[model samples]
Target: KSKFGTDLNEVPREISFCSHTITGNKAHVVPDLSKDSRFVDHPLVVSGPLARFYAGVPLVTADGYGVGAVCVLDTVPREIAPAQLSGLEAIARQIMSHLNSRNLLESERQLSTQLSQSKRQLDDFFDLATDFLGICDINGHFIKISHSFLKVLGYSEREFIYKPFTDLLHPEDVEQTINGFISLESGVQLGLSNRLRAKNGRYVPLSWNLSSNVDGLVYAVARDMTKQYELEKNLIQAKEKAEAAASAKSRFLANMSHEIRTPMNGIIGMTSLLKGSIDDEVNIERLNIIQSSGDTLLELIDDILDFSKLEVDKIEIEKQALSVRETIQDVIGLLGTKASQKDIAVKYIQSKSVPAWILGDVTRFRQILLNLLSNALKFTERGSVEISSDATPTDDGQWTLTFAVKDTGIGISQENIAKLFTAFTQEDASTTRRFGGSGLGLAICKGLCEKMGGRIWVESYLGQGSCFTFTFNALETTASTEGRKKDPFAQIPTDLGSVKPLRILVAEDNRTNQIVISSLLKKVGYTPVLVFNGAEALELLEKECFDVILMDCHMPVLDGFQTSKAILQKFSDNRRPYIIALTASTQKVDIDLCFSSGMDGFLSKPITVNPLFTALDEVYSKIHDQVPSDRPIGIDKNVSLTRKQSKKQD
Candidate 1:
């Protein structure tokens, strides 16, 4: 081994496994071999090819703890600079930093893979959830629908995404939900339980809870309420049937009261006049007592029917041209009388912007206002009732004429205010006992206001009085045209020509009703041919071409349906005689049947002369194609129906 390095050209060759040594780590350096005794006698030191000046450092760990290093080599002994050694040290530090970074990166890669796996599991769980999840934009277009929602609706996510949320809702619920959603967007929360149509065209109930995500985005959770809703609906239907029977009984009572008092109105009126004619004060007092009792009975009947109609949802919106100011005046006048009796003053403020003409269901609006004002009057023994109205623009390019009826009366408690609009409810049971009412007045008012596309609310303090405010969206029209078309009850003729009497056919089974209808026809200057049943009426129609046929339903020989069908088949021509239905039934199914059978119109049973005339005018006048002749021009049914006669008087 000592002679191994003796050859000048021979080199000691050994290979190291660590690759870092490949890059200059094997280089050798020898400095001042002449001064070194260790190499003085060595042949390698004297005659070897490159081992003269040796200076080396071991390459170490990545922390710069040296294991090995590069060295310089030369045949002759030479000096190396301190600056060069510092440069080599800097290179070693660079290599160490690189190796350490690589080791740390590999550790992070493994951790990231584990985290990704965990996230995938969570996503899978959400995908498998039973409750449906969905997200929608503010415009109500679906951004995403859960697999469960798609499965329930029989649709794919591809089909539902980007579609309007309202598209899946039942047609009747679409507007309501949309309106609710709009309110929600304005910081209101909407928890909706509504009907949604399935692909098979059946409706299923869905409950939804929604939260706003980012701007203009909403995340919603929904659950299928089909089974629960079905049970609820069945229960509702049962309740509705029971309510309908009760309503019918109430209506029967009202009818009896109306029929008895109708003649009694004449009797009481005549008897009172008779008592006046007589010089006996005792008889007069007795007659006054009798009239008062009848009046009280009539009032009681009205209260019962109002409550029943509200419960059963039988009230329909009736349109008439009414003077807005006049209606308020009438309500105020009635309240003012009560207020005066209590030594309280009543004031009405009319805003200048309030239009003389308006389009609305007059009877309902007036009833609502009247109920509120009367409540105010009843509660306040010594305070004023103020009715006022003003016009303003609604956001939808429409105008709202708001009516507020404020009263300095016994204010309502905050807790009881919410219950005021509930059916058969007052401030409390005690309130109903103290005040004479069925407790359904405010409920009717709420329903009526909503039907008219308005809302009623109240603001009050406990000791101070209350203010009832309502907003109505009224259709606008030109003043001249409004005045000309407003009146529905005016007697002015469409044409000045002497009119021939209409040959009308009256189909009725009841003898008293037949005579009553005949008398009404005679009063209207029309000669009507009376038939005992629908079959007889149909036979009469075939025998002679009548101007109109007033068909009654539920006859012995044939019902209104069969008779209508037979008549329709016979008169297949487009220009058939007007078939007006006279029926006690006002069910949706019944009305739809009449419409489908080509009936021109329907009149409710126990028809008065006014409604009968109105229906006839609506049918016969529509056929005339010009202005309706029976109802005169410039005579608004609305104003007359809602406004006081005194308000219209010059």
Candidate 2:
């Protein structure tokens, strides 16, 4: 603007000289634009810088897209010397060169501005991020930590940097945190929760998001999880407390069950002993009622305890040889009286395909059948309850035994059938009231069936009846369950009076129980020397030899378990008496304990004549086996023969 007369910097593209020159590949020279038809009507030519002399060249980039142009314009037409004209062209090239250089400088300035802004944004993000950002070396040492890290954990950069990341973690978390570094290079990892020790020596839970930087560094963003962790801890503690309360309740139930059964054993035993002596019909009828009531109470107790055990996963099913036919027949025999009274005939159907014996839990197996059959009988007024079993052999040397209990009774609606096997749910309220049951039998059966690798279901229609079926997979056993199980009283005389009485030591503490047990022994023609506890029994055994020792598992001073162990250790095997454990505990663990502790036999109490007689019979049979056939029978009269057998073999 200083050198030229005026400036047309604001001119429109229509009459712009720079725009016209940009269309040409090189300089355009017009001595007078008004003489050219293209610019004759142009505004700049006709109105302002009129009759212009123009010399212009395009401002071309390196890629050759012309953005603008530089030109010299004069108000009047002019002619120059040839030398001056050539000089002007050279000057125009120089102008283009300057224009290119100016554009380059301007682009560099824009790029510099962009880079500065980008850096500012990145720095802002790094310092102000909500997550605790950090960079660690491959060795897990902190190289740099964001201000958020210091803010979140209350640690200064000097105090945190260069220290191992694991050093800041909770002691228990160190190993796991360190292990994460080795494989982190594979990909980004996030949302891993860990406990970190803060500067103030308090634990801060952090959920981390991490990734591997191409340059041997670990980048991490950690979110504070202390509150979430505390909530989870509270939930866990509540769960633990609930579990503890449940465990205590179970313990109380088991103890109470043991405690209650002890007295009931005495009562049932006394009742059994007195039943035959009572001649009055009314007294006999009353005794029957008492026994039935006691039995029902026993069933209820058993159901409650069994269900509790199942709930706790404490029930263990044994894998052993079991007889399906015999087990079913036995159930039928036990329930025969009830079935006869109701005039509902029961039948057992078995296909020849079913194996004689299979490996399974015999107790649970029988329980399943008993529950289904008993349920069938309760519903059926007069129709038959048919229990059938058939098995299909499996590829793994096993058999799938499908059992069904079909019955005719007030059939369940489709909706109610689903509720049948659930605990405390029977057909209906009226049915439960009239039929009389705890409604836990089928639930227990279902639990037992599932535990034994089987499933149970029912098919029924209204007014028609119900058929309850279950399938069990069992491994074939070479030995028969019945053949291997000998009748304990088959060889022994049940009339204890007929057989000569053996010298017996009864370890019992309760006064009433002592008299009752002694009376029963006396009635059976055996004189028992009763000791108050295991210590008393031990003391008595030191001085005298007895043919049999009836030990109560739980007593005041030194229970039966300890006493039996002491007796076995003290006496030579050949001289040891046949020890039988008398316990009110029908728990499998307790029975297993009795046998494992080397008792000759187990007799669960409220001891009826049958159990007592069976224990005695088994004891005698075991003694007979222990006695060496080669040795003189008198050498070891009625005790386990020692391995040495010094009296005879030596």
- Best-matching candidate per lDDT: 2
lDDT of 2 by residue, 91-130 (tens): 6567668777898899999999999999788778879887
RMSD of each: 14.9, 8.2
List residue ranges in candidate 2 displaced over 4 A.
1-131, 135-202, 207-218, 271-293, 319-326, 355-362, 475-491, 494-503, 515-527, 545-548, 561-580, 588-602, 608-650
lDDT of each structure? 0.65, 0.75
User: Tens-digit lDDT track for model 1 on 394-501?
Assistant: 787666988887878878999989988887778877777888787777776777777677888999887799999888787654333334222222453433112534
> For this target, which candidate reaches the highest TM-score against the unseen true structure?
2
Least accurate stretch of 10 residues (summed lDDT) in model 1? 641-650
In candidate 2, where is summed lDDT lowest over 10 consecutive residues? 629-638
Q: Which residue pairs show collisions in model 2?
A: 265-606, 574-642
Against the hidden reference, what TM-scores do the models get?
A: 0.52, 0.68
lDDT (C-alpha) at residue 591 in model 1: 57
Candidate 1 local lDDT, residue 265: 41
Query: What is the Cα-based TM-score of model 1?
Result: 0.52
